[model samples]
Target: MECNKHNQPLSLYCPSHLMPSCDVCISTSHSKCNGITSLASVVEKTKIENSKESVEKDINYFLSILDQLVTSKSKNIKTGENHCIGVKKSINEIRKEINKHLDHLEEKLCQETDIIWNQEKSKATDFISEIEGKRENLKEMKEHLQTVTTNTSKLQSFLGVHKIEQQVHQCQRYIEDLENDERTKEVDIKMKQNDEIENIIGKLVSIESVGEVSVVKTEINLNKETSLRRKAQVKSQEQSNINNMTMNIETKIKINIDKTIRDMICLIDGRFIVVDWHGKVNLLSSDGKLQKQLPIPGDAYSVTQINEDTIAITYPKERAIKIFNMENETVMKVIKLGKLCNGLSFSNNSLAVGLRKEEIRIIDLEGNTLKSIQVQSESYLYNLVYCDKRVIFSDSRGKAVYCVDDSGKQIWQYKQDLMGPEGLCIDTYGNIIVVDFNSQRIMVISKDGQDSKVLISKEEGLVFPQCICFNHNESSGFICDYYGTYLAKFNLSFG
Candidate 1:
């Protein structure tokens, strides 16, 4: 291979610079460089002799780990299915209660209305009969008067006329008495219209939705006992030889800021960026001393290192991701997106964005959309980490952790006793560390999905843990105690 800089064949290796040098390049530039060695010698020393055997052993080890994870996840899937059946049964029970109550109301209302209609009909029928009787009496009096006037002599007619007149007067008096009675004046029953009652009936027994129902593989343990329990179980199966191993924690810096801390990211230069609930990003030294604070245009929820001197932050409210250049301490560029940016992770020269509705949009550094990934979840995806060509995301509403491939296929999910998983990070050991806000604990899970453990808890004074990050070497880590108004630092003692 020719050296791109010198345009000549590589001839020697320089240990000081850790790169291959050409003859002309070494003579002119690397002549004073220390630890110069031949390229053949360096290659022979670093190359493995039994590469085939080593590959087989590595393959078997990884395959065994994969088998264990598959078994565990299969059990979780069964549990999730059972939980779904239980939820459906519960919903049916509630529906039965609602139907029973409404049916009773309908029966009672029908009976009451029937009684009212019968009473009103009886009053109407009685009024009609009384009017008919009066008409028949009047007809009889008119016929008798006509017979007396036509068939009798003058004197006889005079006597009969008086009697007929008396009869007519009587009939007239009866008719006037009927008119004077209030009950005779158009007796009828009617129901008055009531809009309020109609409105109430329409609103009663209506279906109201609470939230979405989705089946997810939830955690086996819900509190800070996950790690301890798993560790005890593993330790019980074997004997330990190492001694004097202890994990120690300390209060690194307690900055009493009134603002709520959303997330914190550790930089390679021993500085940390603390994002708050508001639009402020605070830069602090590794010792927790305040250095400078930058104000973003919108609420900043996530911060991640893009390169050695540049960091990317998620501005969900503005639907944009801004690149913050650390050297200038200013926003260098803004990648405007059609969807809102929530969780963010930069890897393989691409940015995996956790958008709304549990979707991850993969975009290049230039803000062009490469692909969109929809996670197998109904809840929103929160903080995420990109490591080893995979995206590890936390679902705050679902209370689970999900890992997905580049093509948006879910590999496996881990959930147990997790309340609200927010920010996640991959440690040097390839273990996933999650900060759960609702449970106020930090959980660590192996990348293979076989084991999980709790690193810190509320008992350790971690109140409302938001974000967790490891330093460059992963020997030490930092936790943002959001509501506690402090930062917790812990040292890892690997046994």
Candidate 2:
């Protein structure tokens, strides 16, 4: 019973109540046994296996989720990396564009800055030049002030010295008066005492000889005082003479007013002549005082003072050139020119006339035509003057001037670049004075044609300069303008 109780053999297990068993246990004991431990073990094992299967399935599911998450994460990482690379590339491109734009902007700024710098530099240069000019002017003013100050100081010193000299002279006079008063008082005392003493001395000298010697010494002293007074008077008189001489010299040095005289032509008799624009020919003294007005048949365009009595004038509107005797006031001869004559000059017994056709016609005083020469383009001749055995004329339309010899040969020609050459005058040095109408200037041309100078342009403020006439000695000249009522005077200094 004890052995059966411990081992429990059992056919008592119902087939329907079979315990769960593993295949290993069934193989180990081929028995239908209700072995709760084995059943529990098998059941526990099945449960463990199911639990393991579930865990494995869960693990597989988790692993698949993990794999999907890892794959998604990897894709996300790759995408992020690609995105980063793209963003970096875009940023680099943007940086490059920005750099290029900045470079272009910098270049444009540099160019503009350079232009601004140049303008500023030019302004600065102009400012500097202006400052320099102002400084020079200031320096000149300072120098002038210094000179004036020096002169003022010198004048003040001279005045002070002069006043001191006057004071000294007054003091000397006072001293002389005092000395004279003392001498006179002493002389009076000597004289008064001498009367009293003479009585005493005469009685004493009759008694003693030494008293007479003292009387003689007193007389010698009186004579010396009288000589000293006379010398003082002579010195005062000499000083007065010197002062009077100085005053006379100062009075003689008087200021003179300079008077300008112009357009003076020397006649044969040492008188002078001038042609006024009012159509009057005035005979003048050498001092420029009007002497007389010569009578003429018409308004004189040109006047030649042949001598003090004989004068020739060209009257273009009257179509006659006339020689008149001033003393008789009569027309001596009249030369008729059919065309309009403008200018006239007398040289070498011949009259040179400038015709409207730009021709210079030479005729004698008796109206015999000697020669004719074309000077410039037709219809351009305006004025003619004789100089150095040549006839000089100006051509307005041709803008030129020409000089021809007495034999009708061209010597020189000046092509003026101005609009018109209207007036002609010849200086003593054989220089030509040309008045240009358009430019309103005076041109000086030498006879050799090698030297030309603009003597007066806008500086003279001339408008429509018409006629120019040179003085006989060529010291000065005169110019007339059609519109300008006043005359212009010019100084001529030729080398």
Candidate 3:
């Protein structure tokens, strides 16, 4: 083989190398062979190496993808299996719950059906029993009707016989004859008895005892004696009753006078005020000594002690009210009302004045009217007393006493057979005491609006009680009589 200057083989070298070469050269040439066969061999070896590496790389990538796919498929299968199991379990649980609910519903339905069946059975039994009872009653009625029909047929058959009719007529004629004989005998016996009675009466009239009794008039005398004795007894009883009533009245009067002299009349700070119906305002001492006599400008309807030294007076005729200061002996304020004034009271920093037209006017101390309350009434307002947020008054026309709130709404009212209610007072327990003018009686009514009890019916010792006042602390009251010239007192007690 020939080698080139670069020591390549002739076949591996370029076409320009055409020379002989040594073994080393041949070896070097073969080592550095540039022939097509050598190049083809190198390319085939590199392709095999690259193809093996590529196959190895592709195998690794495919194995990795297969591993991922297997892992994902296993996970998905497990998830699907678990989901199926869960679905089966959930389905089983739902079926069990449905079975339980269905069982409960079936039990409830069975119980309700049983109840309805039992009720219907009972109703059917009752209806059957009722039908049986009605059938029995109908059978009994049929039997009774058959018996009644048989009796009626027998009566009809008996009534149809002519012999029986003739016998009945004969019997009736015999009865009439016997009745006539009895009547004749009765008349004859009556005549004989009358004759016997007349004879006995004649004998009795002729006897000395009968004639002596007639002559003496014993029965008339006995009756006269009995009547006289009865009259005497009655007279004695009436006299005894009169004495007892008189003593009671006297004792009550004395007790009342003593009580009124003690409790109702009080000396407030050495200034004495006499509560009376007179027009004059008498300022007296504790010993009943008149100190100053101040004549009112008009008719003094009411007198109230405002304080230790102040006194209020209502003059209805003048339609005015005046406050008198005893210490200064001067008038503090004078208020002229537009309506007729009747009664006055001081409470809760205000003056409550009663009017004749069934109204109450609340005024301050300075003579300013704050509120006016119209009392519902069919009569004139006679008197009023304010206590416990209630205004109690008497109505002359209605013959009753009424209590109203501060707003003029009626709280209670008591009707009586009084001729006219003139004065009214409330006790400590809110009992109403009324003075009747025409009936001449002291009527006491309970606070709960009951009937009026007659405390003093007639003025046997008293002329006429005009006004009344109560001492709440003592449970006592006083009444001023118009003609008695003294105040009567009473101590009240519960029955």
Predicted structure with the largest TM-score when compared to the true one: 1
Clashing pairs in 1: 218-415, 219-415, 219-416, 220-416, 221-417, 222-417, 227-453, 227-454
Question: Cα lDDT for residue 308, model 2?
Answer: 61
Q: Which regions of candidate 2 deviate over 4 angstroms?
A: 1-293, 378-380
lDDT of 1 by residue, 184-283 (tens): 6664555555654553453342212323575455554313322113344343323221222233576557875546566788888888888876657888
Q: Model 3, poorest ten-residue lDDT window?
A: 210-219
lDDT per residue as tens, model 3, 187-216:
111112344455455434423231110111
Number of residue pairs clashing in candidate 3, backbone atoms closer than 3 angstroms, sequence gap of 3 or more or interchain: 3
Q: Could you tell me how far off, in angstroms, the CA of residue 355 lies in candidate 1 after the best superposition?
A: 0.2
Which candidate tops lDDT?
1
TM for every model, in the order presented, reads 0.52, 0.42, 0.44
Model 1 lDDT on a 0 to 1 scale: 0.75
lDDT of every model, 2 decimals: 0.75, 0.59, 0.60
Please give the distance, in angstroms, between residue 473's alpha carbon in candidate 2 and its true position after superposition.
2.8
* Native-to-model Cα distance after best TM-score fit, residue 454 in candidate 1, in Å: 2.1
Better of 2 and 3 by lDDT: 3
